[model samples]
Target: MKSPETFEHLVRAEFTPKSTFLNTATNALLPARTVTALQDAVRLRAEGRPLDPLYDDVEASRAAYARLAGVPVERVALGATVTLYTALIAASLRPGAEVLTVENDFASVVNPFHVRGDLKVRAVPLERLAESVGPDTDLVAVSAVQSADGRIADLPALREAAREHGARTYVDLSQAIGWLPVDADGFDYSVAIVYKWLLGPHGGAFLAVPEDFGDLVPVQAAWAAAEKPWDSAYGPVAELAHSARRFDTSPALFTYAGLRASLELVEEIGVDAVHAHDVALADRFRAGLAPLGHEPVPSPGSAIVSVPGLGRLQPELSRAGFALSDRAGHLRASFHLYNTPADVDRLLEALPG
Candidate 1:
């Protein structure tokens, strides 16, 4: 797992001559295999054939997601991004119910429901979130990993606490899914943007709606969600899909091809390996930064490491061919499977003391 030399060949990292990219929090580098898939998708689209769910790669993409999430195939649905899926989940909650989230969660996770007007939002600090949930809580919506500080949420504990309050859990896996081992079992609904950690095509995402959520209303409607999406009848009422797919958002027909390739590449590498590689990178980073006396965030073990004063160095470092995201008053250095210890070492050497 510590093969820093061979690991460097896995990504398009050298596309930039003198640059080191530590910014998966903003955008990820596409794997070589994924680029090939994109080319194939564009070529196939040029043949002037209409897209069909059966003929296209949608089903295959769905299957890949199901396998990764350990959920039944029918329980998965594709969305253009996590925003649309979160909106659907927010729309389905009982009217006027409370959605307990955190103030530091990324906007996409909180804004979708907060804008609803009908639901009351009680956003608190992450440390107190589990203690704050009570019987009045109807939904506990949060990111599996806090976007601001890179703190991994205690999923099993939170879900168990939410259960006591009869609250359904909706986890935004955008920051966790591909790089970490996430269990979709405890959460009633989980959503993720594949491009971030999955190294997939942009605008590709998935949502999981387990039957444990009971009856839910699809927030939006598309003919593609009908039981017979291909039926030319186009009747007044659509016989919606029995699975969570009834809530499916319209997909980018060509994008799924690349997405499937990306998913396969990640699976081939195995998430356990990805997580191991990611944590190792973080460990090295902490050790390197520790003696320098930079401030580390709450969880140094996570893939995303936040440090105070790192944000101020972004401009100077960018000129030196390194990249990271400045978010929530700190610079977030995120790692991916494609990243190697050499990448971390480069940043360690490059950063200003």
Candidate 2:
């Protein structure tokens, strides 16, 4: 077993080491390496280092995510948010076609389709989403891990279901990508925001586009999406990139500074190892909750272990310094690499039996 220090040791001591924090579903604590990298980048900029040099950080981050997903670098696009990528996917759908998804998923997934009016979006319950997909369904959208209940979707089954009906699949990996070793074979596109499980700054996300993209336009094109951004202008609209690079959100330069380091850090630790750690902690959390008469919703397989109808207890836990999320009647505890057994003990001690 890798020593706990391999991952946890580098977390900043600035975070109250005495307190228990498990709100990764809401956001994650920045590792000390990422914090230091952000600080150093700011100092370098103040010392007259050209912002142009920092631009490469975007490419570096893309490469890092590409490596993590075992895809070619060209298949990865750097962006500011998962919402933007979902919107971009919506741009490619046929007008008035059906896009099926769960209602409780983050709005970014389904709202884009609703606002466009080009697609008929059905916001239904998770259990109904897969069953609802049919030949008329242009796309089936879901998070690999449900946001509120921590329900891990059976991707293979969902993919098979979607394929049988001639529909495209899109997965938002905001909750499960880093902590679960997800493969792209099932979905045509997968988007993830780095600030959550990725442990990066807010303005960073990635879109894994289809490798066999054909007749797929750059949904919402920016100048950076041009085939040759530096050499071209608004004169004649340059060709959109053939690869996923065309989806780049034209983010701010500083956004990539901290993200590059964080993505690389996740790569170093490896996704499988992270998944094991998260699952083990979540199982431990569930065991503790058993005696408390609390149960995780949707059977916990992901890092997020939420107890239904426990929302009322959130205030008491918060008062004890246990950071968590209480939403829609579920009290959520999201674990990550930095968490330990002691942290879980702290929480169990605080909870009323």
Candidate 3:
């Protein structure tokens, strides 16, 4: 086991705003190394290359992310996962199609479907998710880790059920990636933001679509997604890139650079190792909060530890130089690679009844 001081020093070095604890609602702090790398990419851009191609860092990033997810680089789509899904949901569902999801999910996943007046949306009771899976369901979107309650649904099981009903399954891995293990084979589409659990930049994400699902297309295709990014300023273009790059076009170079750095750092550390370390800190934080008469809501397998009354104690924790967040009436404690057991202890010691 790493020493407490070593852990603190490591975390402090990466997250420069050392005093602030990013135990927030759903978001976690990006790794410090990622920020520095993003700075380097900015410098490189300012230095200027005579001519550079779009997604210059793409191949390297895809290879790295693919290795992590145990999928092929060609199978991955890099963009804001939420945007990718939003576009996909709008494109995939026709009028009057019903979308099924759990009530205890992140608003991002459910809101998009509900907005379509023609598409009816229904909530599957958490206790009866299996029963809810049936024919006539147009799509089933679910969070790998519940954004509100932090519960992890059985994605594999859900996928299996959705398959039986001929419904396309979409999974939000935003809170699960980097904190838990995910099998790419289980879902037809997997969406995630690299910023949160992946400890990367916010501007980029991944949309993993299985090869067979060629019918799935984005509503808006950008320049980068075109077969010839150099040709035509505007038109309804179908000559999209051969891979998931079809949906994600154009380049957010800086964000991509930051994401590359973050992914590289995680790769060096190993995803499984990251999960173990975070779970340990979360466990410590949960145990520490137990005596305060606060109970942590169970999450699937991520580093999020939410206490029902944490927000109520925010003032007290703040007075002690610590901060916490209250989302939907629960206090959420999130851990990242930079966090250590001692930090959990400090937050624990600082909590008030």
lDDT of 3 at 32: 74
Query: lDDT tens string, model 3, 286-351?
Result: 777768877888763557877785667666666766656676778777777767667788887677
Model 1 scores a TM of 0.92
Please provide, for model 2 over 76-175, each residue's C-alpha lDDT reduced to its tens digit, 9 standing for 90 to 100: 8877887887877887777888888887888887788889966788877776777778888888988888888788777787788898998888898888
- CA lDDT for candidate 1: 0.79
Candidate 3 minimal-lDDT segment of 10 residues = 49-58
lDDT of each: 0.79, 0.79, 0.72
Per-residue error for 186 in candidate 1, Å, reads: 1.2
Off by over 4 Å in 1: 1-18, 49-55, 212-215
Better of 1 and 2 by lDDT: 2
Which lDDT tens digits does candidate 1 get at residues 255-316? 78778877887776678877888888988988898777786787756899988767877788
Clash totals in order: 0, 1, 3
Considering every candidate listed, which one attains the maximal lDDT?
2
Ranking by lDDT: 2, 1, 3
